[model samples]
Target chain A: MGDEVSSNQQEPEMSQLKPDPIGRTALAVEITNRLRQMILEGVMQPGEKINEKALTTQFGVSRTPLREALKVLAAEGLLELIPHRGAVITRQSEAEIAEVFHVLAALEGLAGELTAQVASDAELAQITAMTEELRQSYAQTDRPRYFRINQAIHQEILAASGNDTLVKSHELLAHRVQRARYQANLTPQRWRAAVEEHEAIAKALAARDAETTSRLMRDHLLQKLTSIRVKS
Target chain B: MGDEVSSNQQEPEMSQLKPDPIGRTALAVEITNRLRQMILEGVMQPGEKINEKALTTQFGVSRTPLREALKVLAAEGLLELIPHRGAVITRQSEAEIAEVFHVLAALEGLAGELTAQVASDAELAQITAMTEELRQSYAQTDRPRYFRINQAIHQEILAASGNDTLVKSHELLAHRVQRARYQANLTPQRWRAAVEEHEAIAKALAARDAETTSRLMRDHLLQKLTSIRVKS
Candidate 1:
């Protein structure tokens, strides 16, 4: 929660969010967004404690806005606040992870169904390209890059769904497990299976087979959970 | 934003959460939860601006924690923060409302599927009883009571899903549209259709007809949006 607090969040726009000048809510929102990014990126480990003084000092802010950021994260289920004490990034139990995966599967399944029914040809082509890119990443064994591309493909489908709330809700639950996914090394067999699954999903989506696309998308996410559990 | 802010938020549990006694994070969480409840309960109207000073004075706190609550609400899509100014409760557009209903339908669709597959006899009976109660409220033309029972039946299904994340995610999206539902006076025709839909949903659940339950649940929510739009 100090210098290690992911300066990737410290974009030029973020630096301009000085407190009091623009107002507290703006800065608080900025901090909340950045913290959410850090947690999702796995730069901040699950169950890692935040030293309030260090984080405030690191962000060049006071305790108030930092506390505000923590509150927002807690509501998002990305952080846990201990009563009368500081907070920690949340760690999901195996059962909790399974529950979240089930919900995400439903979200992605709906996204696929909607995308098949309405996505433009360009959107379908972009998803196909990402699926191909995901295959390329498979040979390299770079887990983070592969995971990022995989997420980009699902995100593309969600965007095509034309429902912002669907995307937001999916990401909120996805963030809870993305860190685990970033760290969980996949077995070679499972990696091949996931890649194959993506190929089938892309084909179904391109064919505009809404029901098949929906079922494939749902199965894809559930399989991801299976892979994580297998590897762990 | 003062007395009109809803004293119902000031439960005995809430009064115990003073800023200094239990710590900043705890107080912030309390304020965020209560604010969320107010928004959902329709005590806080959409498009209503939060008077930070008046709310702080009323809640007997400083601006720091109250501002913290605002940040959290903004993230949940229940509030919008204006740059340099404070925030206001979010008002959904017709388009936005449609988008949210689609997602909530997907969520409740999954909930119905899971509940059909796994919910115990007791849980199913309880849900059926709520459905009967909903019918009773319909006869009385008590909109709130009917709406509350309608939500309870849905909540019972979500609870029976055994997926806490599913329940949490559904509520987050449901909150976005619930204020509108509470105020949208339904036509008798639409009301009768909704009641019929619930009866069918309960029958599907009782018979363990997963596909029908899932389809019925999704259609039920979308039809609710249709009802609201019809009345408006």
Candidate 2:
């Protein structure tokens, strides 16, 4: 399982595009994505050592690249590295987790405003489709499928915002506050409540009401935070 | 020069507090801070190799600790690690520079709102003092001095907001968009104009006007972006 996970993360193409060029950035990005996935997927438990030698071997690279990858992960708040010891995956305290949600609320609120201001007919239709898909998945009791659609809905809104910088910042915040067990651990009641929140955001978007959409999106995120905080 | 930089960064107390008996987060933090300072101080330029062997020797540590330290630095967006090669500093482009300012404008706008909502008398006074220092620096054409005071004023606002998460997010944005030269190269006339913008923000804060303060802060950042874009 470890081998498969690490092997699939072969360094991004830009790493080899130039001969002996500044490949660290590419390496860092490759590392960042892989680490993010591992944390979110629960492949490596939080606060694991991220064993440099093991990773170097598993990823078919040397310490240099592995270390670089660790750095990138750290930037996203996935991995934490010690000065003299080495790197390990990071774990969030309950308070820190709440902090992440607060930032998420702001970023998503910004994204909602931009999306309402710019979403096209096609985009709105796509969101509507995803919303339906999520509803169907929930009915089928397919947690993973429901979650995927839920994410797609959010991502669609973010992409429609016409602001790449905002999108990237939001992504960073999302990864930092990894939703590892967020939906997986949801009660049926909580799940239904979340779907209702999504519907509110979609309806606001369809109305092209930036104020309502922004407020609804913020409320949606805050609702999740409140749920997660209480449970944590 | 490298040796001097390393010597000054040797913080011994990082070993004293192990928050978790088995965890190494404190170590990661120490390394992160040291590397962040190196990058921010320009001792480590973008795209420079962060050789583990050399770093290990310099700090009188083994590869294990050094690698861990590198991971923390990478996460902070200071280093880029290549799979086969090694870590190097990250470089910014003209477009990226612009994107950063756009994000900064929104973030500072948020900060301004929070600061206005909750500025203590002491905090407001500090901001006023910093603005005065900035004015003095402007009169003397002291760019470095002016920059320090300018940063102090901004930090005071961030601090007054009493949101650690917001402050950290803003710090990340600032670090990611580390283009000091963009502000440094501004013509003296433009610098003075910026100082005047600071005056507006300070006045709004003094009046405890949240809406005006937030609007003026957003405008201040936008003006900076416009000036830099024009110059670039």
Candidate 3:
């Protein structure tokens, strides 16, 4: 649940390896994470060709490792491998974007339900802390900073729900939509509305009302979808 | 959506191309579909190595196309690509399985909500028809037949929701878990209970009560989780 910084390595060094039998998996993960960040940050635009030869050379790895990394990204819905065209960054139509948010709403609703059912004091405390961080970022009118914290709070809810599949699928869909960037251009009014929803979500979690929490969560996600303009 | 089937690939030769060009993307997709079926049907087992050269010969494609297909599978969570180990089928831990189910529950719940919101009389009729099919199968005590219809009813609900992302994620997770065999092993009494739950789900959907539909869906999924052994 770390920020994009952890995922921003464009030319990861392959010189070093962790001392473990599963080190290869770790390296593959590093590659996947970095590629995901690059895509999300717009360094790699949607539908751009992924030149495997260039990637292999840039990462100082062979085609074998690079191929593995590409596969991992493809699974995350960040890339699509086009036959002779090779791997390309994923792009979504407006219809696809709408579909993603519809799913997200449902997923976040489930997260809210689970969070209400099982969020411990510590989990709640962590969420509260993120909410405060979001508030500060909002006050400073820093979009990227605010965006990071906002993303963290949403992710925190997903993790606290104790469902790995939901988290992974949610992240996959989110990535496919290039994260919508809806929250990035947050208007002051919408920011306040978002803050209010966070407060409601927190309160619902505290009360452990699954129904209310689920409803609030769905509403929260739908609000974001409505605010964001899907790219043509 | 349909049972994971082995593509016969024996269709009568069709026209060279349809109205649209046979885009590079389509070739990658066709290759990926074939590879996915292989893995799901256990033609390719967990940890079984995939040789790019061998696949190139088998699929009658170049290394570039084969590599792209591997990348596609890798993205679907069906194949794991190691740096040097190449690609292998994915295996899940018990914890991971539980995690997948938890997410499935949420996604299905979402489907239920949307189904209630948008499922038309025709869609409800379709589900009802499937329910009858299930009843007949259950009466015959043909577990496999019952399972197929059961899968259809659920997929129908997902499709009726009109959310592609939900359908895609739900289908992917369903394939990965492949819990039909486990469910097929349920005792007669438990099996009856499961069928009864399905009946309730069908009725709730027919009634178009969003709350009841969602609640029934969540409960149905939770029941399966509780009843199954969830092999470690």
Q: Give the lDDT of residue A165 in candidate 2.
A: 66
Runs with alpha carbons beyond 4 Å of true place in candidate 3:
A1-35, A47-75, A80-90, A182-184, A229-232, B1-35, B42-71, B85-89, B179-184, B230-232
- Candidate 1, overall lDDT? 0.83
Q: What is the lDDT of residue B206 in candidate 1?
A: 96
lDDT (Cα atoms) of all candidates against the true structure: 0.83, 0.73, 0.75
- For model 1, what is the alpha-carbon lDDT of residue B52? 89
Residue A82 error, candidate 3, Å: 4.4
Query: Which candidate number would show the highest lDDT if scored against the true structure?
Result: 1
lDDT of 2 by residue, A1-232 (tens): 2234334444543554553555344554576577678778778766566677877777776777566566667666676656566666665556677767766776787778778888898898788778888888888989879877888888889899877767778788887676533633577888898888888888888888888888788778877877776573
- Model 2 DockQ reads 0.21
Which candidate ranks first by TM-score, i.e. highest? 1
The worst-scoring run of ten residues by lDDT in candidate 3 chain B lies at B1-10
Ranking by lDDT: 1, 3, 2
Reported per model, the fraction of native interface contacts reproduced equals 0.57, 0.23, 0.53
Off by over 4 Å in 2: A1-36, A47-68, A85-88, A118-121, A135-142, A180-193, A203-212, B1-94, B116-121, B136-142, B184-193, B196-200, B203-215
Each candidate's chain A: what TM-score? 0.83, 0.83, 0.81
